[model samples]
Target: MTTTSARRAPSGSVSGRARDFRLYWVAGGVNLLGSQASGLVLPLVALAVSGSPAAAGLVGGLGLTGRLVTAPVAGVLADRLPRKAMMVTALLVAAAAMTVVAGVLAAGAATFGVLAGAAFVQGVAQAGYESAGAGAIRRVLPADDQRALARLEARNHAMQIAGPMIGGSLYQLARWAPFLADVVSYVVAAACVAAIRTDLSPQRAERPSFLADLRTGLRFVWTHPFLRFVTFWAAGVNFVFGALIYHTILVTGRRGDLPVSIGLILAIASVGGLVGALAAPKVLQRVRPVVAIPVASWVTVGLVAALPVARQPWSYGLLFGLVFLLTPMVAIVFQARAITVTPDHLQGRVATVIGTTGEALRVLAPVLAGVLVARYAPGVAALIFALLLAVLAAYATANVRKLRATVPAVEED
Candidate 1:
């Protein structure tokens, strides 16, 4: 393994500068599709086996617990190990787990324990794969290539929209089909990653204790004001949106609206996300963070605030579309800024610090929304989440100026 600096990348499209990035992107896209499809289908598999909603939820939670526990540890490993090996190993482990599920299903011997175990193992492997891949991509691509990052955002949204549709269709055909599809996706992704020409090795010279390495990751994020603020902001945003989407679907279903109408509303919101992700590069490129960051924050605030008023299906779709439409644009701009400023050695740690916090907080979003919907009118719940977004919006407006002054080297592409 050899060491190279992320800062050494030449100025160009990431694909042009890092010839291996095309492979990286393909690998990422395949993995995203597999993960999304499996995530939705796994709960259904559990439901089929156990015939209990609680059992299904527990199975899903176990998977999330696996990821949450492994995520921080994986970040340290990503910085200490050869990233390519880590990535390939992670994919193989996950694929093997899915193989077990597929085999059991085919044998007509699928059980709760086996499927649950496989899901948890898959999640653990996924965490490691993501932690390593983030550092690897950052290492390969030019630090300033915001367009490439935006492309990743677009890929995620596009695949996410397609994954569940594909998964549902496949599951109707055969219970084991989605799991097998995931296995094939993993094999393909692993092959793509293995083909990358970049040197995907750790740059650090000294090894630290596990606890010490974990502390370093947290310390780096805590010391960086922009990163610290954005971490909390992201968590809040995730929480609000998660609740908003969940409740919209739930309440719509309860009202006996045609499934197609409800699906259309959600589908429109997803389309907005896809469009936002696609446009994020251009939006990020043209806008200066000083001006862009604050304006976008307020725009989200306004859109969320309007959700309570969108009662009809068409209106819901339009308003939710507008809300999500701006979300990826703002988020990608923030991601571009963070990725550019993070050092090569600390990339994995910094990413985990922020990502883990956001996921942890987001777990509570549905609980809060459930309670709110049961007790109050939908508009009141919307107002509460809107207030949360407003606080972050104000924080962003106040902090962007200082971050600009302090981190002078990072700028919009």
Candidate 2:
């Protein structure tokens, strides 16, 4: 396997690389806040205009469709173009789109069609930004500082909690309020990208066709046993976990017997994820990935297995929260290991490929969950998904152990 070592900055009070990473991190946080806000606001806007829950759902689905369609192409561009430039352009475009949407809504001229179109554009821009941003991190951070990377991942998870709350609160003030906030965030994110001094363009001798480049990324993941195992394992877990969450919300709404708010339930889970991310580096310091990931997976299986029987809002939230608490720790170890081994030239494509695999079932899973809940009981749906997760977790644990036994320690390090 070919690995790219991190390039160190010249000696000084603070390295240019370190400064640039800080700037990039700020940019990501700002952009995430905006994106999360828009994610909530856009669907609400659609529902306001059309007065149809299904229509609102369609608007959200269309955004995901845009992301899914453009992800591969965005990945290719991230590898071919300058990473900072790609991020800046994507942010600028997103800012402009959000600005227009905000203006239209403020003017009382917004329509469902217009909102959906803007959402799709924003989604496409987000895909490019995320692809380039991943490459930028690899370029700026020292490969050996896995703890730093884990911290950044944790911060991003924290934003997941903060962003939506900010958005929801602003949305209550006015429909346009959250969108205007997003517009400002995108502009600030663009500025942060512009401020990054370190050059993050791909350094390759010759470029291949887009198809070939895409295939190269796929082949790399497929051939690497650990990456392959993690990819499929993550995909399965993501799918089942997604279904479980959706089923919880759906069943709760249908039953109307919950003592707590669904939003609170989700917030608790998000908070748990943030805590997990924050604690991951410390946990990984004591336990290696070979040991940590499988243990977490099995623990996740036990937590999920109990979800079917827990119908009370607090009980469900506690179980899901515990499940989410383990997620980021496992994720950080896998991601840090993957980034350490992946070459810089392949970073963008490889990151995107893994992201695509992880997200492949996101849209489908909710739909499947709804069907399952409708066909049988919510408990039945939860149990079935839990079983699927357990099976996947077992498979992943075996593969991780086998890979650890076969691979050299230095490769993982």
Candidate 3:
């Protein structure tokens, strides 16, 4: 297995890296706030527009579609082109989409078609931005900096905790508000990407065919055992977990529940995730991912098994919160491993391959959850998905029992 050697970063290096990352982090936080607000309302908008659970599924699925279709190409470009330029372009595309949609909403047209179009466009842009995301970090931080990785995940968890509450409040006031926030965020993100003094361009010596480069990435991951397992395992979990989220939202929304109540439920889950993020470096120090991941997976089984008894959305939220608590450690473990294990030139491709594959099943998750929850009792649907996740978890645990992970020590923030 390829690995980045452990090292103590010089104090000057640490300070430089920290200074650079702060700007990027600020931009990402701005982006996350908008995405969270929009994420909360987009499906509700769909459900309101068409009054069909399936339409909600379709609109949500379309966003994933845009991501899946462009991810591989985005990865290649991230490796060949200037990452900052690509990110700026992506931000512009997303901002334009949100701007147009908000304008339509202001004009009082709540059409499903326009919302779907905007979702797809935004998703495409998101994929492009993500393809460059980790590569950008590699430019500033050492690959082996586990604490920095944990901090990155922590920011996401923090945003997750805050986003729904803010989104819910804004949604209560006006639907157009969140989309307008998205436009402003994109501009901020673009400026941040452009302002970074670091050279954030690919440094490859040769240009290969797109297909060849893609195949090389695929081949590398396929040859690795742990990455291979995570690729499929994550997909199944996403499908099941995604079902639960959409099912809860759709069922509750159909019952005339207010957005704030739903946001609180989502925020509760983020609270757990935030705790886990805060503890990730400590957890990773003591526990092997091989143990942590599978244990978390089984714990998830127990949670899902109890889902049948969750009578209210808040009850479901608590159980799901526990599930998310296990996520940040496991999530940081895998991503940090990926960053340290893969070579710099290959980071964009390998990261994207893993990312693109991980999310592919998510497209179907909302649709499947929508259909199942709409057609069957909540308990029965929950049980069915629970059993499905149990199998995937068990399989992943067995395959990875012998594998190991290596992460570097924490750096001063």
Candidate 4:
């Protein structure tokens, strides 16, 4: 059996790499778009269907929980199966789940329970699909191309800028329309993945029970000092980001003066991410990852903490601009670091672990943020998030020296 780390081909062939990236470019891009569309629409749907903000928070938490459950196993599956097949299957399953959502909506019988159940199934499939996608990229591309692929990953962030706005506009036309569109996007992604011809080299592992394999993934992260610190940093920052995201919605909806729509918020956030993604490679090329991580983290914390204090709409706009300016840079650097530290064969499992942790934090943030909103004040959670981020920023900087020493083995395009 072949493994991604063990396989090597001559580098710097444009035609060959282009052919491989086409599958990721098309399928992955569409998936990102569909996901963005669904992400924005789902919360709105939850709000409408359930008529309770707490229930909406539960929907997000439950979805994240499902992703957490699948992440460990998805890594094993990515290593075991053909990557292309796994990605296609995952997309197909997600599409089917969306179709179920559409049917429930069309029947005018949708409930919060139904949405939660559907989101759980869809979230599991999404984790599997992403694991396979990450593993496939590790198999197909050379090292330099992988870095460039990080830019493409940034495109997903860019979509975040546009997708919510688009979904929100579509929602105005009809409540069921966004889900219908999401289903179609998934179908297209499935077809695009099927069109790709590259093979995913499967590694032979001793057949372990699923629980055992999961333990292996967890233990690997625990024993590795760099992985441990990086995961901790990612988890902490993600929790802050998740809290900010929910609060952004709260600010827009709860504030009487500023009637910023969901679309505008998504656009603003995405714009920030796009700026970061575009600048990531350039920044990494200049500054060490260790230096960049703390810088970006502090900038984000500073901006978010100030957001709630901004009494006027213009103040929110100023804070929003600053957020888009710096946070995306942090995200790209962190992601590139994650990709570089792990061996190619473990990319899927590693990504799964990373993603699951982030999602789990997202789940926790909403529940906690909701409590803050319910008890103390509207934007109190954002203030606490800022303080927590400040502590984590210091932690990341302290560990930066250790992480910077682990230079990736360079391969060419």
Candidate 5:
């Protein structure tokens, strides 16, 4: 493996790349805001129409299912096509879908089926856009921009806070408003992506069959112990975290808490992620992954164990926030490492496989948590999740030291 700096364009002439990246950043933030807004609005719309919480969950599940199904195909296209063009096309498709949905809502003609179908389409577009956008980032920026990557992730966290609030408020005012807003955002994001001057198409000598490309990605991850370990660890942690979040929601709702209060608590927890993202690059500069990964894992274990005791809203929020604070830091380090190690031609496939693996269990976690909460106490569910986290922590503690020693040194820009 070669250093990124060795392959990069002259360091002195970074103004063009910097400008292009800034545009890409703005585009990503806009797209994320729209996606998050739609996420909130879709379920609420379903709940309103069907008058059943279960129906709302089904609508959300359909969206995730769409993403899961499309991810592998999206990964292959992202590697073969021009990333900027793919991103623009995806944004346009999403915008068109949302616009039609908005029109349906405005006319009071939307049913659960219609909404679910639209959500699925939007999800597919979102998956493609994200996969291609990641490839675009790799093409436009120098690989060693760790701080820049951290900042991008931090901005994403900030949008997660703002998007829901804006979406919820808009949904309250009028059902069509949130969808309309998302349509506008998609258009703006498309324009931003189109304006980037860098040619973001993959440089390939020959294209392989789609199935062959997908298998290559899977094989690479399977053969690399570090990639395999991190992917599984990420999946396990995400599963537990998803369950914990659902458990919190169940507990709060059962207590007859106000919806606004629950939203506020969750939003407060996201602030911790925002802070962690800002701190990640500096922290990674000082600490090695071997030390940081295990320490963070054990800390998370302690926090999950303590969750059973915190009953009040503020106390619960604080503890939840603290537990999530480590997430962004660890994610930043892991993503930086993954990008550094992966070949340029395989970036799209590798990123997709890793991302898909991490998210595959998340859709099931909420349902499992709800079942557990209904059958047992919330504390019992928390205990089970804590035990799961503890197992993952132990695995990391045993394996990370060897993995860290084997990692190739990839120099920063």
Candidate 6:
């Protein structure tokens, strides 16, 4: 295996490599559809079954909790397990969880506890899939193909517009329809993994001691200034973003017969994200990650903060467009940074840590956001969160010295 610096690719090298990336993109797309479907369906289900917006909030919060709780363990397993197998299992488990939720809804026994439990399991499944899938990208393409990776990220953003609209439309017909459809998409995603051409083999076939493996991954993160800074900034931004996810959905969904309204906002936001995601590689080629990331974060921070004060379509629309463009860019740049810094053998663990830490903040943020919204207006919380994000963005940019010089340096063991 090569070293990270050994794989440093010229920016112009990504052309003519579309075929390899397309296969991986297809699988990602399948999962993306399922994710988008579930995103809308889960909240709707909780709202319908529990008859309270708080129940939906709890369910969503628990999912992030599951992700945060499972990430460390999943990180270790990602290094030891076969990537495809891990992803397939994650998809299957998620499918089963959704299936159970669907059945409970069908049976009219979908209590808050049941929804929370299902969400927790689904979150764990998502944790595993994310850790494995991020690592698996190396198996699918060479270093120079990162632009393709950016495109996949873009495609996912695009689906945010398409998937939720479809899911929400379907939800209007049968509340359970979205969940059932989500299950089938998972099945397809699993099959796609099984069909990938890469050899199915774990990198650490002997399975190093779990504690030892975890320590190594953590040590890399701690010792590396770049990872440290990025993780901190990402955690902060993710915390706020997580809150928005819950707040926006809750505010829109519970307001009235506004599923379409929610979908429309999401679709418009997706358009902005789609543009950002698709253009990320090109943007990064011209601008450094340090500059790009802080700009994006600040954009999100400002927009989300104004979410509460903004009266109607005008302010909300502008906020949505601003955050939409910036958020996806944040995600893309983060992936690019991770792909650069992580050693290939530790990709799974690195991914796990990244997902976990971000989600840990996310988990707490939503619960707090909900509580605050319940007490004060959602606007107040949004303002506070936005202000915090502004501080975080400033800190990130000020500390750019720690990460700006850090280029990608990954390799398979």
Compared with the true structure, model 1 gives a TM-score of 0.93
Q: Model 3 compared with the native: what TM-score?
A: 0.84
Between candidates 3 and 5, the TM-score winner: 5
Q: Model 3: which ten-residue window has the lowest total lDDT?
A: 1-10
TM-score of each: 0.93, 0.92, 0.84, 0.84, 0.92, 0.81
Model 2 per-residue lDDT tens digits across residues 27-134:
999899888877877888899899999999988887788778889998888888998899999999989888988999999999988888888998899899989987
lDDT of each: 0.80, 0.79, 0.77, 0.72, 0.81, 0.73
Q: Against the correct fold, how does model 4 do in TM-score?
A: 0.84
Q: Tens digits of per-residue lDDT for model 1 on 134-219?
A: 77767666554677777788888788888888888888999889889999999999999998877778566667677887787687
Prediction 4 global C-alpha lDDT: 0.72
Higher-lDDT candidate among 3 and 6?
Answer: 3
Clashes of each: 0, 0, 0, 2, 0, 4
Give a tens-digit lDDT track for model 5, residues 313-396.
Answer: 888888888887887777776776666566565677778888898789887788888898789877777778888999998987
Per-residue error (Å), model 6, residue 40: 2.5
Candidate 5 matches the true fold with a TM-score of 0.92
**205-319, model 3: which lDDT tens digit per residue?**
6777788777767776776676677677667777777777888788778778887667667878888788778887888789877788888878888888887787776887898
Worst 10 residues of 5 by lDDT: 2-11
C-alpha root-mean-square deviation, candidate 3:
5.3
Model 2 lDDT at residue 286: 92
- The TM-score, computed over Cα atoms with residue i paired to residue i, of candidate 6 is 0.81
Better of 4 and 5 by lDDT: 5
Give the Å error, residue 3, model 1.
16
Worst 10 residues of 1 by lDDT: 404-413
